[model samples]
Target: MRDVLVIGGGIIGLLTARELRLSGAEVTLIEMGQTGRESSWAGGGIISPLYPWRAPEPITALSRWSQTVYPALTTQLLDETGIDPEFTINGMLVLDDEDLDQALDWGARHGQPIEILQEPAPHAIEPELGPRPARALLLPGIAQLRPPRLSKAVRRALEKRIDLREREEVCELLVADGRVCGVRTPKGQVEAKRVVICAGAWTAKLLEQLGTPPDIQPVRGQMLLFHAKPGQINHITLHAGRYAIPRRDGRVLFGSTLEHAGFVKRTTAEDKEALYNDAIELFPVLRRTPIEDHWSGLRPGSPSGIPYIGAYPGIEGLYFNAGHFRNGLVMGPASARLMVDLMLDREPILNPAPYALNASR
Candidate 1:
C-alpha cells in the first residue's frame, strides 16, 4: 500500500516517483523487467531542442526548464546514491545555413545562445573538422546525460524509500470502483491511492487493458556506438536529421534512423549503412573510425509529437506521462515536475494546454 503507484521503471517513471517522494508522497515503483533496461538505457543521452523550430510552446518550455533542473537533479541524486550519473555539457553543432537559422529561432526566446559560425569558429570549438566549408549552428548551452547511468542512480537513490518491484510484470490494472486503486501483477496486487502510467513504448497497451484511451505508438530509432578518437568532435553534430554524440571516452556515438518498425528491435544492415554513409558525409573523419556496435530502441510517439500528459478524462486518480517520442530524455525531468505540480496542487511552470490528454488522433 502506498500513496502513489508508478507503472513502468524507465526514466520518466523513476523521476516521477522521485519527485513525488520529495514532496512527501510514498511511492511504489513496479518494473516489468530490470529497471531502465529498455529504451531509456538505449538512448544516446541527448538533451535536445527539436529541429526546424517547429516544436510546440509547452514542449519547448518544458525542455528549457528541464535543462536548468537536470544538472542539479543529477547532482542531488548522485550525492544521495554516491554514483556519478555521467551528465556532460559539450553543447551541439548543427551544420547548414537553413538549419542554423531554425536553430537560432528555437533558442532565441529561451535565452540559450545560438551562434552562427564560419570555418575558424567551428575550428576553434572543435579543432578537428579541418577545411570544412559548411556553416554551423553552435548551441553552446546544450548538454547530454547518460540515460542508463542516471536511471541506475535514480533507482539506487529511491531504494531506501520506495518499494521497487522489479522483474514482476503487472498483468492487470485493478479498479475496485471504476477508479485506479491498485495494479495486478503476477506476484500480487499493490494498492495505491493514485496511479501514474510511465511505461515508454508499452504505454498504449498498458492503458488499453483498463479500457482507457492511450494515444501512444512506438517509433523505432536505430542508433550505433563507435569506438573512435577522442576530441574529434567537440559538440554533437546534426546533418540531414542524423546526429552524433562524443563520449567522454574515445568512443564516438553515431545514431538514429527513425522508422515505424512496430516493436521489431533488430537492426537492418541498410539502416546501419545509411547512418555510416551520412557520418562520412558530415564529418569525413568518421571514415577512419571503426563501427563497434549498432542497436535500436522504440519511442512512444503521439499524433502531434507531443506526449500524452495530465489526468485521463473520466478516469479518477489515474494520470499519464508517456508518448515523449524522440525527446524523452530532454523532456523527462520537466514532465515529472509538471506531474508533481498537478498531483500536489502546485502552480504549474507552464500552461497545461498543449499536452492535453484528450488530444485528437
Candidate 2:
C-alpha cells in the first residue's frame, strides 16, 4: 500500500504532503482541478487575519506559528526552485476602532507588538492614505506573501519529490471494518495505508459519505485587483470589514465580501463597486487606477472559525485538515505541520486538543 494519499490540492494538501514526504513517507497527492487554483490562489495572501487579536485562540496560535516560520520556509523554497514567493514584512494597519479596547487587551496578553496610533501616524506611515483614521493599530510583525507564487513554488519543488496527480477527483473513501484503507476515484481505487481529506469547501461532500461530516459550509469571497506604481501603499491597510493588500509588483488587491453563496464563485458587479468604494476610501489615488482583475472563490467555513485538523472521529487511518475558511493562507503552514505530527504519533508544536475533529464547536 502507498504510505499516504492526500485528497485535494489546495495549499493545505500540498503542504501536508510535503511534510509527510520529508519525514520519509511515500506520498501521493490527487487534485480534482489544477493544484493551488482553489481558495488558496483566490485569497488576498495576508499572513495574518485582519484584527487577529480578536480571533480564536487556536487561530491565533496557528497563525503565529506560521508567521514565525514563513520567512525561512519561503527562502528555502526560493532556493530550491527558482521561484520567489515575495514574502514581505510590510506590517498591517488597522483603521477601525469598534473593537479597539478588546483587541488591545488581547495583544497585550499575547505579547504582540500592537501599537495604538493617534493622529498623523497613519498618514506618516502611509502617505497615500486619504485621511487619518479615528483610531488605528499598527501591527508591525504582520507580513504577507503572494499566494500564487508560494503555491507554485511548493508545487514546483515537489515535482520530483512526491507523486503529484492532477485532474483526479476522489469520489469516496475506501473503508474496511470501520477503518479507512484508501480512496475511490473515477479512474480507479488507489490503495494507501492512510488517507487525508484536504478538500477545502468540498470536504463535506466527501465526509458525508463516511457518515462523519463536519459542519463545513462554503463562504464565497470576491476581490478586485488594481495595478499601481510600487509604494502606493506601504502596508496592508484595513478598515470597516474590508482590506487593501499591496503586492510588491505594484498590484493592490482589494477584497472581499463574505457571503454564504454555496459553491458559487461568481464575481458580481455590486460587490465590485462596493469593494472599489472601500479601496478608494483608504487610498483615493486608487480611484484613478483602472481595476485589473475581479474574481471569487469558495472558503470552507467551520463552526467558530476554527478548522478541523486531526484524526477523523470514529475512523482509523482517515484524517482531515480542511475548513480553514478565509484564514487558509494564514494557517496553512502550522495546520499542515500539526497534521503530520498527529499522523506520526509525535507531539505537536502547539496543543492539538483545540483543533481536533470532534472538539467542542
Candidate 3:
C-alpha cells in the first residue's frame, strides 16, 4: 500500500503528489486521461488572480504565497527536469476603470504595488494596445507561465520520483470500516494509507455519495491562441473579463469565456469569433496575426470561486484539494502545500478554516 493515492493528475494533483513525496511519503497519482491535458494545460497560466482585490481573502492568500515561491519552484523544476516553465514577470494592465477604487484600496491593504496609468502611459507600457481606456491599473509584479510547458516540466520531475498512473480512471472509492482504504480503477483496486481528491471539475461527483460535497461544478472556458511577433504585447492586457497573455516566444494566449456548460470541453466557432474580436479590440496587432489554436477546458467552479482543501468529513484518510475555478494555475503550489501540511500534521502556511470542507456548513 502506498502512503498516498492522488485521484487526479492535474496541476493540483501533480503538485500535491510531488509535495507528498518530498515529505517522504510514497505517493501514487492516477489520472482519467493523459496528465496535464485538462484545465491545467488549457489555462492562461496567470500567476495571480485576474483582480486580486475582487477575490476572497483565502484565494488572495494562496495566490500571494504561490506567487512569491513561483520563481524558486520553477527554477528547481528547470534544474531537475531541464524544462523551462517560462515564468515571466511581464506585469498585467487592467483597462477597466470600474474597480479602480476597490483595486487601489485592496492593493494598499495587501501591500501590493499598483499603479494607475493614464493616457499615453498605458500605451507606453503596451504599444500594441488599441483604443486604450482613459485610465488603467498596472500590477507590475504579476507573472505568467506557459501552462503546457509547466505541466510537462512538473510531470517530468514527478515521473522519476512518484508512481504516476496515466489513463487510469478512479471510478469509486473503496472504504472499509468507515475509512477510505483505497480506490477502484479500471485495472484493479489500489490500496493506500490516505487518498487525496484533486480531480478538478470532477471533484464534486466523486464526493457526491459521501456527504454534503463541496459546491463544485464544471465551468467551461474557451480560449484562442495567436501567433505574433516577440515583444508585440509587453504585458497581460485585460478588459471586460477577457485578457491577452503574451508568451516569451511571441505566442499570445487570448481567452476566455466562463460558461456553465457542464463538462463539455468542445470549442465553438461562435466563441472563437467572439474571442478573436475581443482580442483584436485589446491588441489590434492580433487582427493581422493568425490564431494558432483554439481549445476549451472545464474549470472547477465553486461558490465565491474559493477552492475546498481539507480532510473529508466522516471519512478518515480521505481529503480534498480541488475547486479552483479559473485560478487553479495561479493557486496550484500553495494549495498543494497547504493540503500536504494538513495531511501530514505539520504547521500550515495559512489558516485552513476557510478552505475546510465544512466551512460553508
**Which of candidates 1 and 3 reaches a greater lDDT?**
3
Q: lDDT scores for all predictions? A: 0.82, 0.90, 0.92
The TM-scores of all predictions, comma-separated, are: 0.94, 0.98, 0.98
Candidate 3's residue-wise lDDT over 1-361, tens digit each?
9999999999999999989999999999999999999999989999999878989999999999999899999999999999999999999999988978899999999888999998989988788789966899999999999888888999999998898999999888998887999999889999999999999999999888776778999999999988898989899988989999999889999999989989878999999999999999888889999989999999999998899999998889999999999999899999999999999999999999999977862
Query: Which structure is stronger by TM-score: 1 or 2?
Result: 2
* Clashing residue pairs, backbone N/CA/C < 3 A, model 1: none
RMSD of each: 1.9, 1.1, 1.0
lDDT of 2 at 325: 89
Give the CA lDDT, 0 to 100, for residue 69 in model 3.
Answer: 92
Candidate 1 lDDT by residue in tens digits, 1-361? 6999999999999999989999999999999989988889888888875462667766677788888888898899888888877789888877656645565766676687877887677778876563555577777778887788999999999899999989988787777666888888877788998999999889888788766657788888888787787777778877667778898886777888788888887889999999888777767778888889898888888776788778877668888888888788898998998988988889997776677776553
lDDT-best of 1 and 2: 2
**Pairs with steric clashes in candidate 2:** none
Greater-lDDT candidate between 2 and 3 = 3
Q: What stretches of model 2 exceed 4 Å from their correct place?
A: none
Candidate 3 residues lying further than 4 Å off, grouped into runs, are none
